[model samples]
Target chain A: MIGDAFTLVLLDPMINFLVILNNIFFGSFGLALIAFTVIIRLITFPLTRRQLHQSRAMQTVQPRMAEINKKYSDPKRRQEEMMKLYREAGVNPLGCLGPMLLQFPILIALFYAIRQTLPESPEALEALSAHLYQWTYIQHAVPINEFFLGIDLKLAPNEASSYLSPAWLFVVLVGATTWLQTKTTVTTVTDERARAQQQMMAYMMPIMFAFFALSFPTGVSLYWTINSLIQIGFNIVTYGLPALKIEPLLKSPAPAMAPALAARSAQPQSVAQPAPEPRTPNGPGRSKRQNRRRRPE
Target chain B: MNNPRFFAVGLLLALFVVTSAACGKIRQPEGWASPAVSDSTAYFFADKDRFVAVDLDSAKAVADPKSTTGATLQPLLWQFPSNDQKDQDAYSFKAVYTQPVRDGDTFFMASYDGGLYRINAPDGRGERIATQADIKGKIVAGPAVAGEYLVFGTTEGHLYVVNKNNGQLPVGWGKTGKDLGKGIWAPPLVRNDTIIVATMAGEVRAFGLDGAEQWQKRFTASGAVADLALLGGDSIFVPTLDRKVYILDAATGAQKGKEFVAEDWVWSTPAFAGGVAYFGDFSGKVYALDITTMETKWKPYDAGHRVKATPVLIDGVLVLADRGPVVHFIDAANGTGLNAVPVVNAGTVRAGLTAAGGKAYIATTKGRLFVADPVKRSVVEVGVGGGK
Candidate 1:
């Protein structure tokens, strides 16, 4: 039942649309995929923009959040302050995740769609037929040309006939653009522990996609590569060059400390001494001690 | 607890794992076994495990469970042994390609597992008389039997001539044996005293009764050749992966007339009736060519899917099925669709259309059999499990 619904909702439409786009693109499967990716990116542009805006909002409020952590010793009080700060900034902590979550379904659907578009076997051909809608244009577009730029769109990128094949070019694009997109979009975390995790992901996500592109069809990798390039473009437009730039100074603990110190020094000298407690690894205060203890690990 | 980025990282890992594992193969749609309709019964390989026999008159399983007096009800006339492990890789390209060839009282079948079985026609009980496991090559095509000799080809690039009487391979076949150079992927066409064999190496050779090559001709690029059709016992109509059908003189293997160029590869064996040859290309275009003039008699009909199934001529109508569900009936003379909507909303048919006893039987990959009476303009879908 779930399979039928999934085909009906995503696979069927994607397969049909891909076939239609293949016709429009004059039977080039690769061009159709590139066009399809562009169209999908445009359709989800609003959500992506909102997600980027939410990430920027999160970054802008990070210093204030750290200050709240310094001010409140109680865990509940710290959470309340963080929630209040988020509300005042009109930022939902999970807002950036919504679009990413939505894009997952589309990505999965596209993967299957690419596989279905140029079916190698008769069984797959039958599936392609079933997924295709009854539009006259789409019906006539059966057996779309799978060859584009010397790559058999059905075979994996890494499964290229030789090292000199164009499939290797797709692999490079998938890897490079994925890395660029992740580098531009990943938030610069303030907390040491979270920053480490974020940095790991920034490296890992692209490498994972690149590794997957090796085995996935060149057409799908083409989609991912183009999608990544589009995302990099969106990122640069949204946040400027600074989004892509990873400064050594920004990597230091100095920027995080500066904001907390600046906020603390505004208070009286006696309260300022308490600010140092927030930095202590084994600080006696509950939230400060918990956070500091968690950071070193 | 407060690390959204860390949470996202974990989720990405999980997604990678899930998608990678799930990405291996989409659910194999279903098996496609074309119906072999005899006078009273339709024998079909429903799947790897089941070879079902259905009563044509009642359009149901021959074995009626409700009416049987025995304690245990045998559902059909017979089913092949249901061994999943033995037939694990049966759905691949090497799976059964030959339609059940009935010779005398026995039916010869070549399965995907590379087993050639001789089933008793009366009961369907079978034995694997030959196997690829023993031959060291999968039998991708054939069991086209004649008289006492059964001729077939294997993916191992050799043709085997097996004795139908005792199921023993003749000495002069295969690599450790004769070695036909490349694989024979299509069933050879046997005529008179000679058998015409098309090989994966793109060479068509006619072999004499004594297993000696009579005449050989290379027509296309080295790969598998589609089954060839004989035109008036003088010309050989062979489709090739080269996207053109070549008409070769049967006597000398010389080119005859112009090459029929198609938009895509011509894989279906051309069917000839009344001087016009009908066939479909991989691009879903069906053409009716006048062999004498080497020109298309009418505009090609687009069936809107890959037409792998050979077009059959029934009662002056050219019947063909595509990879899609719909079967099209084209007017033999004009190439126009016969029905109002051209038989809309039927089972997805990949198997060839079998016209027998004034009706056409279409077996889909999903195992739905559509019995269409073109005279009546009506179609009845037979159920997968039991016949309808």
Candidate 2:
């Protein structure tokens, strides 16, 4: 019963859409995957935007958050104050993860879709017949072309041809795009400890995804690369180019260490106010004149 | 952002990723069909592009020099595309999964490219009898050479009947003519002027030579029919993907008895002997059933791996090869192991065992052929030949 519902709700639609895309795009599965990623990202843009807004909101309230941490000597009161602060700012702490959580079902369905479209075994093909709808367009598209751009989409990027194959380019793209997406999505926290943890995740998640891309089928890696690129594009539109800049990452905790240096050189107030919401510069609080001055930085 | 709900969503995403990876299915690779042995030669798919003809006499002569190489002994014999042609990439050029069938002096086989070739058995000379343009889809099943015409089904759910001599389709024998409405993975069983073809949609249909439908049987709950075996001169034993064997009457397409349920799918062709049918399932258990009564003859034989190969009988011993690197020999009468321990050295025998001239030939996925004698309890490996 669960299988039937899953097929009806997610797998069937994904498979049909992919097949139709393949048919429209001259049977190039690679191109079809890119088109599908674009469609999925477009459909999920609102959810992703909500998550981005929450992350930017969290950044906007970081100063008040740090002030609460400093004022409340008691840990319990600090926690209560933080929740109250979030409520006043109209930010849901869980909103940043809601879009990611919703993406799981779609990701899994796409995995099954790629496997079903390019089944490697005779038994798999036979089993796939049942999942496919009774349509002539789909029936004629059986035994889909696994080759695109000289890579067997059914095999891993490394396994497709050999070393330095076209799949390698996909591996690199998946890594680069995933890194950029992660960079943009992560809120720049004012707390040094929390920022360190978020920065670690930003780098670690991309490397892990890239490793999987090197191991999974090229078709799957193509999906990841395209999906990541779409997310990165979405992030750039929402957060702008500075959030995507690798220079901040290369500075090695310079933003995190800035306040400490300022506390020693000047006042603690000057230290807390310098890095005010880098992710959302054009928002209501940060004036256009101030944004122009910060643009050169 | 770090809260119970945030961590809860992350946990769910991680759980889904692990679950998806764990539940990912691995299918049987294409082109693992067993070899067909004629009187003097053993024909098998060496790869997709090359269907090799191993001279049995030549192979035996090398093992025992006292044995003579007959007129058919041409060591490497003949392969498709000849020796000079650069073998096309298997991805671009469809590979041959169908076992080669010998009809008179010619060997007939179909490829993934939907081309049927009629090669002169003795020499390597052959011609492309049918192309994908003629059939309109890939040919997953081998050709069933019945009389002067050759019939085969395609992945496009269309059946094509063409002249074995010319490769041209007979008038009205394609998608426009008659189709099974689903892909046909197994070769059609031609008997009594009727072509019996099973579809991946869990359907069995028969068609006349004139491209007319005769009868159809549908198993709504059952999966695709993987293979068919004839029993009691009239009953058709169907091994299906739904893990059940359905016995149907050949003449009228009626159910003969209750389905024989298995632990998993019965994907391999079942072997019959002494009023009993022996087959294995994807779950690695072999079974013997009384064809007349639909009852188990003995306890299921366990091979501990997927048995996709059709079990063969040689000298009262049932040889069952598996998807792994082992082959088990059991006594056909009681389903007892004939040898103390099964031969665990054959190396991934996905193709079924071929028995001929008092010897059983087993082809491994590693491209090595092991010729075993059930009587002597000996197996000898043959050298690679035909194509590189």
Per-model TM-score versus the true fold: 0.59, 0.62
Candidate 2: tens digits of C-alpha lDDT, residues A1-297: 987898889988888789888979997888998898888778887887777667666666677787665455446766887786666567777777766766688777877788888876665664565576656566556556677887778777655546768878777877788777776664656766577676666676667677767767778778777877777666666556773363322211111223443353356665544333333446534456655866876
- Each candidate's DockQ score against the native complex? 0.10, 0.16
Error of 2 at B172 (Å): 3.2
Q: Candidate 2's residue-wise lDDT over B1-388, tens digit each?
A: 2333444455456566656766776664556667878877777765656667777675444333433532222366666566654354322334666667788888787877666677787776776664323575567766888777888887757777877886556655753335667777778888888888887777888888887777755443256675776676687888876677888888878887788888776777778877788998877889998877889999998888777888788778888777765667788888997652344554577677888888778877655677777776666666553332
Candidate 1 at A238: error in angstroms? 21
Task: Give the fraction of reference interface contacts each candidate recovers.
Answer: 0.08, 0.29
Alpha carbon lDDT of each predicted model = 0.67, 0.70
The superposed Cα distance between candidate 1 and the true structure at residue A266, in angstroms, equals 16
Per-residue CA lDDT of model 1 for A1-297, tens digit only, reads 976797799888888888888989987888998899899888887887677767776777787777666666777867877786676566777776765676567767777787787765535644565576655566555556678886878778566658888887877787788778777664556767677776776677667667777777788788878888887777766666663463322221211224454565478757754333344344544455465666865
Model 1 chain A worst lDDT window (10 residues): A248-257
Worst 10 residues of 2 chain B by lDDT: B64-73
